[model samples]
Target: MEKKVIGRRERITLPEWGLKMVTAKVDTGAYTSSIHCTYTEEREVDGVMTLFYRVLSPDNKKYKDKIIATSNYTQKKVKNSFGQAEVRYKVSTKVIMFEEEFDAEFTLTDRSKMRNAILIGRKMIQGKFLVDVAEVNLSLKSKK
Candidate 1:
């Protein structure tokens, strides 16, 4: 398959979460992708263990404090910016970029301090995309 060229920064859509055009940083240095989560908790619902979480910030007009639950999740030990290993919940979800949908894995973390809510790491784009630092929002511009 031909690899698509993605900009250093681009707007992405998380259709399953009802999130659209969320700005994401394409970081080839990082090994795995991550999505910002203000809150996260695990609860036992009926006979199954369910994970409940909220995406983005409550200040955002569109997706504010909406509780999203999923049972398909696992814990992964990922290194933080400080190079410290931290255990975070890893969830498989669909991410739309360059008008193409792909199954991507994202680690849930608090990125309220970061500029972008989503971080597109190497794993998500491995063998699938090439990052070009010279451009930004290439996907959005293609739609125009």
Candidate 2:
């Protein structure tokens, strides 16, 4: 089991959502991975409680006007960078990192103000990846 060396920033994809080649900032301080959602709402689908959300803003080049919903989700309160506690929706989806794919949980929230839409937290890369502060897109070059 060799660990993959990832940089501070890496290219990630969500095949289930048809979102690819997106940039994500790697952060060791956070515990749960989060993705930028342009819109989110709590709704009922066929009597099942579900969350309706959309990723990648319409302004983004890769934006394909996608809307995703999940009954398999939960709500959690997390402290943001400014120490403000906010409630966010957590959902599960398949994530592609460094050529490897796996099911990952992501907290959905409005990240329109952030430079990068995706933030890869500590839990997402804990044992599988090693991050180099001075590097970016190391995995991109390898197509991994």
Please report the candidate that would top TM-score against the real structure: 1
Clashing residue pairs, backbone N/CA/C < 3 A, model 1: none
Cα-lDDT of candidate 2 = 0.87
TM-score of each model, in listed order: 0.96, 0.94
lDDT of 1 by residue, 1-144 (tens): 888888999999999999988899999889999988989999999989999999888899788868889999999999987799999999988999988899999999999888888999999999988889999998978778
| Clash pairs, model 2 backbone | 98-144, 99-144
For candidate 1, the per-residue lDDT at 132 reads 90
What is the TM-score of candidate 2? 0.94
Off by over 4 Å in 1: none
Off by over 4 Å in 2: none
Candidate 2, position 104, lDDT: 85
